[model samples]
Target: MDKEEYKEERFTERCDDKVESIGGDYDLEEEDDSPVEEVRVTISNTDDPSMPCNTFRMWFLGLIFTAIVSFVNQFFYLRQTQISIGYSVVALVSLPMGHFMARVLPTEDFNLLGWKFSLNPGPFSIKEHILIGTMTAVNTSTAYAVDIVILQKLFYHSEKPFIAGLLLVFTTQVTGFALAGALRKFLIRPAHMIWPSTLVTASLFRSLHAGNNAPGDEGRMTRMKYFLLVTLGSFIYYWFPGFIFPTLGVISWICWIDPENVVLSQLTGSNGLGIGTIALDWSAASYYVQPLVTPWFAQVNILIGFILVAWIMVPWAYYTNLWNSKDYPILSPDLFREGGEAYNLTMILTKNVLDEKKYEAYGSVRMDSFFALTYGVGFAGLTATVVHVILYNGKEMLARWRSARLENEDIHSRLMRVYPEVPDWWYISLFVTSITLSLITCIVWDYMPWWAVLLAMVIAIFFVLPVGIVQAVTNQQPGLNIVTEYVIGYMLPGHAIANVTFKTYGYIVNVQALTFTADLKLGHYMKIPPRIMFMAQIISTLISGVINLSTATWLVETRPKVCTKDGYPFTCRNTNTFYSASVIWGAIGPARVFGNVQGAIYSPVQWGFLVGALLPIPFWLLARHFPNVTWLKYVHWPVLLAATSNMPPALPYFYTNGLFIGFVFAFLLRRYRYNWWARYNYLTSAALDTGVAICGLMIFFCIQSWDGEMPAWWGNPSDKNYDHCPLGAANYYGVIS
Candidate 1:
């Protein structure tokens, strides 16, 4: 059913006596005496008796999808333009697969020695779908430890045993997962602390499991049929840009028309400011933000910032030669030296230790103006997140904390009470075990001091609640990755391995916690047993660590120059950025780069922190005094900054296409055809994403990529400028002098 019909159904079902007992909505503590209107969200309450969670089918399907999705995640994680199978794809594919197995496999219980089991449990159930989605979700994002592996191999030119790498990945990923479980009372149990993304999955489950003759069954089936049609269309259409016609990925007509003009190419090429650049590649457009999953409200704020920085600011800066932009590429993630060559990291490093004498001679490292500004914008985003949370969500968070202790409950929470809650001790035991394992791995393999591991966990613990609050409310995660790296780098300067070790634990613990908490909220919405959810997540998380590390090792060994300019599709831009971050924050150290005010190219970048910190104050004041200003409510300072933060990993065309499509659906279509938008919007997203990912995966294994040779023709050019831009387009990789 659509959102409006679902709400109407709930309105009829709800009574004043039971209103306060339901789960999805929460009460915010108000400092002002404005009357708060009660808003209610209704979810599917129907349950099928035929399906039992934790059955053989769930376990079987969960493992199968987890392995496949984990491999997909790792493969893309190592690529220049990363892609992954969203949980929606897993949900969409698993439902039919589960039912097909149910029809074919024997349902009769079999006795094996003293055990009784059935290959096909009754009918494939909604709980089984939830289990599969949850397991694969755990593996959907690359394991945090993969970064450590990438840095070692690419930056340090060293390799660790595969076993050690796997162990580290498992330890780091699971430790934070355990912590998220331990804090479930605060993050998960409360009905009002809604994880927004979970709602989409919950809706999908409800629609898939609706009885044949149920009230909205016909509409739900239509939606499903529509989703399939879109999926098929997307799957077939992807072959063009994905393989046969790669120029379709970046249809830079402006560049095509003026291919010989350097200035015009700089303005319109994919590697340049990308004015009027069109991207037909789904992977490029949705790399950072998934259009279907994100609320239009959030998308608008992000797009405003993206347009300002990428379309307007970056071009202006480059043309004006801001921060020596003429000396380097306008859009590159690579660090540079004064002579416009790739920063020769060896000159400033001896045995992974900073060489002060050589560094003084080399002068401070320079950054492409665009790359430096991106960090400055990210810093602004970080500070703005903290400040915005305080001004906007502080009271709501306080109220939630106060109410979490009381006997307050919601409908879903009440339903969940039937199952035995997972014990606190289970998480405690897991945390202790993983922490011990992590410390052992760090000390033995990386020579990181025991104390550094303890310090990292402490950082994770302190930031979990605050960060959790922001994400739970706004659906945006202000990263702790940069802050953690800087903190550890300063304390343990010169020890590159130890700095990275500390940075991984410090940053990833919080990230892992948030990931697990999101899944827990999903379980809560779907009414899956909490204990079962815990098992699925922890098991999948552990498995993902091994799979991800193994994949990274394979790629690094076989494709030695994977992140280099020559690597193209396999260039590992994300990994290269991670390597650069390690070099800047670990090897040379932040103090040396940012402290030398006279020589440092990034000296002005530090002001972003202060500017970001101060920015939220005036907005808050305006919001408080002039509460009637509706536009002020939309001014999310942090989200604006976060939009610019995606520029390096996401091309200028990403935002251009994303904004046009996002606004068309989110604002125009949503306002005019509200019901159609509600019904088919997410359905279209799920179908398109699934189709693109499936086709992309097929193309990788079946064609184009197998021989590592490109068929030279007019269509597929050799200079890497497939769109046929001018010579200036080459600067995107590096403008080496």
Candidate 2:
């Protein structure tokens, strides 16, 4: 048989096996109310109402993981190569811990206030496992507002009181919970709103709880055993790339061929164009794009977009001296003067506000060609997201919004209705309380005017649904950072603190809302009670916000030169990028950089907004006309444009390496080795992440904490660039320092 026929037969066999394993009346091939084929195969349509979810064992284990995850994420946020501990890692590690507690803890029931629960929750069901995953998932990344706090204390030389910082972090993180709760009917209840990543997590949870194999799988190794083996192997393998042979992270062989040739090195180096770069390190490769989890189609779109911009357009722009690119490094995130020296913020600002006299003498603030273009790309991404969602999902969304309840409720939604839904008033009260506190914190602390804070909320409310829809369907999230920064930069110039504060409120609120919505869908798939999920999410957000701020403050106080290049591995790459953005759009103001006031050298970049809005139209129209053209429907413009959004902090090699790996696993294996791909794909992704995170923490605490260094060798270079392409940082014009 041919490949397509073989694949179809295998898929049918798998679906039959899944139905038999689930042991339900619902037939996979005949159920009209089922979701897509992908969801049907991965998630069970059955539910057990007797499973214990809100037990003492759940809260104790959930809270412990939440604290550890928040602390570890915040610790790595300052490093040169930051690695996030995603919820999948937590899901893997917490399983054995929960089962062990079930065996050890007393089975006797306890009374708290009016409710009764047991300490040991009868062998730890999938409900409790999901709740623990939800709690850690909420705090997997550090709170967004912590970046503003770091920017204020380290870069701006001004610090806010601890209480003010706490309030800011708490308010920004949970205000979106209210928005998420309000919009559940349109975003969550519909079967078409699949939320692909949640399906992977749900699959992992079910597999962990499934004690035996199906009839066709008796000889194969179980998923849990495979996971443990892979995780152990990953932990042992990370030492070479993580410490002993650090150059394995970025094997730029083309640059090694002729490191002194500035143009060739700049094109092939890890820090530059990354034409032929390869990374053996799983942490570095999977840092930006989670290869195994992201769909192959989405990876293809991102690769196409990255190549067009990073390879073709950027080189053309730099060589042609667009915006005088020859004066600066071909690829950099730093703001510079006309002569290629770093812009001195202290000389131009007075008390964190721009000094008009000093600014006039300092000339126009400049960014490298790539940095300026990425902002333009970000502008395109935002508009493209709105347009793409409208073209693709508008009618369904409108119909869902108009109707009180969906006519065709999927089995998952029907199962979820057995539990009491979270009340509308619960979310409304939270929104009112958080927004009120946010207003007070901003006004009382002089962060921004009350009107700007309100406007920021307005922006968040406007964008959440469309952005959430895009993320729900595609695994990519188009950021609101550029739009927020541009809006506030124009409205209130020369105030750096006000810029970042507005950004945190406007950009992060939408992100937090989507996060809550995704978690709710996970609960929906796993059959956890709505009220229980709501309470777990809120509690976790509050706890995580407090822990995140405390950890960031402690690091800033104890570490000397904590954010500067002199800090070595702790150079705070992301925070520095944040500071550069503040200078470009806030303190320096866009008028002097992109506006006509200073001749508008980079003003042409603003065309991206129009370009993004229109780019989706042609492909959408073609897809509508040629419905048989299957590939046309997969042309997602939003994911394409947002591909390079993480360029500055994420090097070019991350995308190059990630896309290649994604192709190998998501495409090649899924097509050729269907059974192995289904059984171990997500497990492999989770194992690699967990192993790398544990090894990184150990290396820091045991070896690097006391100032011990990897003895200098060819592999462990003295310069620490790793790519060994020194000339990549030099400008073509040979500008003097």
Candidate 3:
């Protein structure tokens, strides 16, 4: 397809009057509507080019928040119930701080090397606010590479040099920046790729700056006021779930009815099927799925998948004793032996490589029915993503690829053309540098082979766009970890470090790239300079990588029994899961677990790839044939299959509770209370997240950190199993650890 033809087919001619007026406020009555209704309402079509973005105030505040968020997130990463302090929290906190700095800092200009600038740049502009958000967004979660470091140090008892780990983290974190930069034309500049999650953040920023005094907004609570009030209420209410009456987090009344009945506990416990579970805590409900910001259709798809896998498939598999499921916990992240004992890595390894003789004696590594099945689902999710995207978005993607310089741009893209674009060489240079460093880190440190590093990058490059398309449309990403692990496990069977390193590079690079792309889309919508956005992302990624590794290293070294169950709240749930993956896919290898080897039992699970690839075909055909059946179009196979991806670490209650809330807000409230939903939906989500995060941090520092314990009672049980299901973690065979 030629550029003109592609442009004609994909987009309408550029309307200058709609977006060319600089320094004009967004007048909704006068402007043309965006192709996306969500974007039309949530984001402004107009731009103010005079607004300053790359300011001294932005850098100062952005760096400070980056450090704080990186440390806090990594600190909580080791806890039993992990809570992330998201970018929305940063946006809320930074607003007043930015204004305070603007008020206090001297406006007097400073000259350096013939260039002039000021510490305080007039009033705090929305551009500066967004730049800060861009910076902190990169640090929202702990760097993915840190998981490898933690896996090795805490589980493997072999820590790589600080420099090696640092380079590994930095290269993996920033490599995606290059890919995102290259794909911006397809993912960001286009109008239809709304990146639904960003709209929430954008709406929050606009509300903070635009104020509540807009002419028709009388009697309605301003967004900022509403956010603050909800935040305070959430903060106060979290104390019960966070500490005092912890049972409120997961109220499994069915388990309470008969804790002594193993079958009932397995069916209804917080750690089991979580039947009849009610999570009053926002943190518990929103841990895996962010219900408020996610669209109703996507949430429904996820809920369907969760029900199939968790509620139906898993229970049936356990009761039927599939792959010795009755011998292990009904749902657990822990790897197990033939007799339901924890798989000891030390017994199976000799100098960090699996020993054939020791492995023969130690028996095969196993997992519960839920964990094994989730891997199969993951396989399906990956293939389903590729097929789903090709079916749904192939034409547009092909057109975008053919049209190098798209002429028919959207209002946001057109407004963005005024600012200088980040040069392609900038991304190319960074990409090359990061890849070289990654290869060196892998080969020199013996984390993985040089060819494995290249292969990992290849996998990431291949899957990133398809997976990114899924996340862009629906706020869920199907991960590459399962694919990466399966491939490298067969390739390098006995190397644990190599397997994890390969997975990190393959999975995290794609994830980080999508994250960077999402931020760029946010910048495009808010009309920030592209060059400035690039700078913020790179700097924040680098800083956060360092902080994440440092904090993780510090905790592992200083906190005694940090990863052990006896460590109380410090029990490393995620790190343990990472270690389990390393064992199944690296040290023990998939051949010994899923192949025709001596102990192999679940080879049938490998058929998931075919299952996943074919599942989308029928859905696509049905949607095409029955064009009038609007609901047929919403059957997203990728989202549905990937729904149970967080199963072992995230229990069934999380989905059940999150879906209930999603129905209330995304469906019922969105349809019944359009005005309220439009105004406060995203804000409510942000406020809830912020409140939970703040309350969690305070609980740790003020009470938990100092060994301040709550008095033992019914709600705050001494056993600490808040659901009161004592036998939930036991196997049907009566193996209780």
| Residue ranges of candidate 1 with Cα displaced over 4 Å | 1-40, 44-51, 212-221, 708-710, 726-737
Q: Give the alpha-carbon lDDT of every model.
A: 0.76, 0.83, 0.84
Worst 10 residues of 1 by lDDT: 11-20
lDDT tens per residue, model 1, 402-429 = 7656636655665566556788899999
- Give candidate 2's error at residue 348 in angstroms: 1.8
Model 3 / residue 461 / CA error / Å: 2.7
Clashes of each: 5, 0, 0
Query: What is the per-residue lDDT of model 3 for residues 371-447, given as tens digits with 9 covering 90 to 100?
Result: 99998888888889888878887786566444425646777776676666888999999999999999889988889
TM-score of each: 0.90, 0.91, 0.91
With a 3 Å backbone cut-off (N, CA, C), the pairs that clash in candidate 1 are: 21-410, 22-410, 22-411, 23-410, 23-411
Q: Of 1 and 2, which scores higher on lDDT?
A: 2
- RMSD of every prediction: 6.7, 7.6, 6.4
Query: What is the C-alpha lDDT profile of model 2 across 188-289, one tens digit per residue?
Result: 887777888898788778877876757678889977788888888888898888899988988889988898888887788887788898899998788787
Candidates 1 and 3 compared by lDDT, better number: 3
